[model samples]
Target chain A: MIGVNSSPPLPIDYLYNFAKELFIHSGYVYFPLLFDPDVEKELKASGLCSRQHVEIENSSSNILLRDRESWFVKGMSLESFVSSYEKLAPESYNQHLEALYKELPFLSSIDDNPITDKLCTIILEILPYFVSKNRRHERKKLTRDEVLELVSEKLNIPPVLPEHARRILNIEKLRVALNSLSKARPTCSKLPSGIVSKTEFEHWFSESLKAEIIKNERRKIKRSIASREKFARINEKVLAVLFFAAEKGSLEIEGFGFFATEHEGEFIIYKRTGEYALKDYYGRIYMFPDCRVAIRTNGTLDPFVIENYKHPFLQKHAPGQKICMRNTLLPSTFTAQNAIFAIQEGISALLYGYKYRKRNGYHSLDSIPMPGSTVTFDDYMVPKDHPRILRGEVLVTNEFR
Target chain B: MNLLDKIKKAREKGKASIGVNSLNTVIAIIEAYSLDSNFLRFLDASPYLIVERKNTGSRFTRKPDLRIPIFPLTSRRNYLLAKQVIEAIGNPYIRFSRAPEEVYLSKFLYRENPSISHDELRNYHFEILLRREIDKKKSKNRFQ
Candidate 1:
């Protein structure tokens, strides 16, 4: 299951087909733009490289870089790049650091590198990127007061010197003692109050402190696992139609369809007259919601959607605009709640009428921006004596599941 | 190493400290397996010893049913089957190399519930096999 959903070959043809499907769903015109001859030639030549090289070239990092650079060149600035670096690059900073060390081994040791000034200057230039990139799920920075409180809670010994309790508390010493004790070494007999450590005392303190951190981490992991389980469980019932497809192994050959909807887009227009010129534009196009429900069960987790679109006015802009298909697999957990709900809300703001305009404290109830409208059905239970079940027998359901 | 090797090493290191009173537990396990054709096949393929808990209940009241000898399986197929059987029997303290922890086995069973399908079982087996393969490849790479 680990390797099954790993990186797979991204066929351009399949992507195009998916784009076409999106076009159809979104009421957008399908304009097959001609690729730049030079870029096309380069791509064709690059195709002769070994498969591994191709894989590295097409990796998410390269794709993200290309997209970011394109956005930046098109009037976006380095500020935007710096601000969005973490969002753009979700991979850990350690991985990036490892790659950096591998590339410039001298950077591994901070004390010995001769080019430290130049390195520092270079890093300063890219400091914002690294700063944003390293910001994983943020935790509240503990103050001195909080740290003392946490340590006291872990130690839990009655106050001996009531007046000087705070002054006498040595956090560093306690931390060192705790760390050593954690590794099953009981050599810390040199306490300020020269007392031999007792097993009961050690066990009580160690279990309490260790449990605090371990419990928090375990809770986080369990929540994620539970969320994933819930999503899968709900999908099993809601998307019962696709269950047959997976069961029959049809997903190996053909992908199933899930979503279809439409939304509006803004376009600029310039009008020229004898005295003056003015410009304004607005247009409506079909749009598909991002809740892809057709899970490929043939040892792959690739998402697929088919689209087709036709419109008269779109032909003029076909020469320059290139359609792109980018996917971001958001953090998902198997819980009873649907993982796609958060993603849907994020996409909703982007697709709804240029900017989300609240009409009398409510936005437009367009089908495209809302999930579960088209793809997901309400949870239903099969009734006994229904058409699927024979009429003559009593429904002897098992009391225990 | 195979289960036999693990048992031998554990005994030599004085870690196989279980005494005679827990012979009932060993007998219970063997009896439980004797009813299954697949487990019987594994038993026939390889030599096995059910390490008993000795002197467990007030030293004088306990005695082991029998003392079994240590012998390695002759064939690779038999050895592998015997290994699977022992792993499936679910003893965390077995000390076999690359053996899954009790938590992993519980998680597997929990996830594959209602009932486990053939594919589920195959995938579980394949996961362990793949892990061993990856470890071997890693060690080889490290050596290189």
Candidate 2:
């Protein structure tokens, strides 16, 4: 029940694809003939061939296969298949084949046999050529001497001489030199006199030398500070210059007040004045607790209004005048931790608000600060009779002014 | 020089002697010395033929039942000189056991003259004495 067909029924390309898929899916790419009994039975049932015979030829691409009827199937080995197909279809069926080849132990059993050893040597020789910069640039083959030179360069040492001159160096002489160099090197400097005794003179000498070097550095520092009085006069002028510079620099004006920068001669006053044309500063602005304010008036001021102030206020006028305008300056509830937390939240809100406004054309939260703006004392106002300006039962004059 | 000339020189230097109990060993010593007349002269002069009883029994008896008389050299200088002559001929007598008498007899013979004869005497009197001693010991044991 055998069919004698002179030619294969299927096209070589189609048969190759089928066999390649079969080999890959079953992990039999290397040992194509090594089919399990069940798989062999399945293959026999398929009627492609009665038997399978695979042969791996000398480290070449070609594989010679013999069927049950003594028919032949010539193709490439697994390595050749990977190399040839890696480029054609890098992400297709061939990609899977290459991956399986790398993952599976295809040549795991190959040892130092003549054939395998020769193949390895040849591969090692040609590997550099494959990785070289220029593909078409033909360079001379590396001689044994050149290879040795490359090894020396890799080891970060001088290249050995060629041929007979490259014998092993005298180990005894090298060991002696190394020992002498180690002994000649300095030792730890901090040990006490009695720690390194006469029996250990070399150790003591090296340690003492190191200690002397450190002591000399310390002495140099002590000598530099011997004439401190001469530098005191220079230090005073430096302090004055720094004070003036800081005064002219940008000031963080805070508290319940209205700030204005004024140039009085050469000095700038970051003025905080509290005088408004409004009747109720409480509803208009809020003041932090424990702030002091100064109130001044030339006319009668209501006692009930001054007594209702949340903050202490000091009132002052021209000899006998009524309390009217008051200015307060005090640290806000912005502790370092609170300030950092506020800054983080403010920044996050600003970024989120900016992005939200950019996308939707409006801010989602009304309380969030606008980008490039900071919370300041100008955002709040002081009330009348505020403790900032008013004492327990009387108004005090502005001491800072 | 040839072997005979060397032996003659060894004998003249007073180096020749043989073990008193071992006939085969004595014969071998004589034959070796005959190759050199100087060695023969030393052998003839030696007073005592130092014998090792244990090693000599094999060459003397078939059933390994034998005893032998051992002679000692008498003079120290002669013994030392004779030893030097024997060493020159590349043959030396090493004593495994201590025997002051044997050492003295050997020294005396070496100082006398290098022509003493002991091969026939060794084969006869020394062997008979050993046999008679062995017989006397066996008879005494049987009677007891």
Candidate 3:
């Protein structure tokens, strides 16, 4: 009787875990795979581990001597490892995997096998079939060379033999393919037990072409979101708030408290009970009331004018007015550097982004109205001698600097 | 001229990111993607990444997740290079996600494995992985 949970440890399973830890520590996944001489031969023969001589882009390009150590390089990818491990790794390698598997201790146990059959090893698992949907049942058994050609075309993975065509009359895969085309699962046309339609060889080859495409797309989006998530952790958030505060030098995220979590978009939530003075280039100063700012991880300020005031650029003319960033540009990918620029830019816009004379955006800072628009709220205007002017730049004397 | 040296220099110059002084952390990322074999896995694996428990990552709450920040403790000026390096690494897990970002002693590796101290694994297991990845990054066919 078979044990319920006793499947043999697959090489893929062992390598998967190792690759994860590697990716976490480093952004990349890799391995050192130069323990045996036959590895190169088996890899070349089996069409797994498909990395080639990459001439290191050093200033001195003529260093061919050192360049010769290409195969002995440190890292092998999961795909390359997966491709190679099926042949090079021991079946028991999975059992040997630990939170710590070393080179000599575990990796060295992999005894290499000389290449016997090239295409059969990684075909179904590593290399998905490139068969088109309409061509599922076009005819009888395809020759071995035909199958190899199909696999090669799928990923431009060069054939192992590198020949015109390998002409085996009866490869086991094609035999199965033939059996799929003709016989019903319960032995033949005269089958007894199983349903005929449930078993089709088409699922093996035809369906995977579609599956691989979808998998690739999902992989792209998932990977972007996943790695991107790493940039905005608690460690980074604390640093960002501190850096922004240091750079601004006056404002503090810790005015009340800082709340950074996924729900609130990793924010530096702060409330200040005093007024801030905002000035434009044309010597126009506006006194703003007590402000509360929520700096998001994306480097955007929310409810920017939390004390409720109105200007043309404000989304609304009431409390919790969000500033419009229609005139600014920010980075696409999220990182701390990008965050700095975003926060700085956001602040800069609030501080000196308006032209009182031109009345460029929603409303001019001065009393000048747009061609057909009216100016509201002369109440917040402050004279030059106001005591609570936190931020505003005005030209005082030409020779002061 | 050396990759590690380059990374170190970048890190030093990039001290503006604050508290990201760990060379190994940055090296792990760059080294993993430097190999073509590993780089290609990004294309193959969907969500090939580590979830840092439930609520730890920089913007785990929302990454659909564009509105966030990470000060680059290293590779500061070359933010785009950092991006490319990240893209190149791709997720290698393929059909799998949700693996532990940092792997510790697996139960299968040793019988009564809890008997051994974390120090032993730190000295032997992890060090070996890091060294191998480093060696690979320093290889002739590096980043192929």
Where is model 2 chain A poorest over a 10-residue stretch in terms of lDDT? A296-305
lDDT of 1 by residue, A302-346 (tens): 222222211111112122221121243433332112222322322
Of the true interface contacts, what fraction does each candidate have?
0.00, 0.00, 0.00
Q: Per-prediction DockQ scores? A: 0.01, 0.00, 0.01
Better of 2 and 3 by TM-score: 3
Worst 10 residues of 1 chain B by lDDT: B46-55
Better of 1 and 2 by lDDT: 2
lDDT score at residue A31, model 3, on the 0-100 scale: 24
Using lDDT, give the best candidate's number.
3
Ranking by TM-score: 3, 1, 2
What TM-score goes with each of the models? Answer: 0.14, 0.13, 0.26
TM-score of 1: 0.14
Q: What is the C-alpha lDDT of each candidate?
A: 0.27, 0.30, 0.36
Residue-level lDDT tens digits of model 2 in B1-144: 999999899888995564443222222233223323344354443332333443455445322112322432112222334344344432112121112222223333333323334452233333233344446657989999
Q: State chain A's TM-score for model 1.
A: 0.16
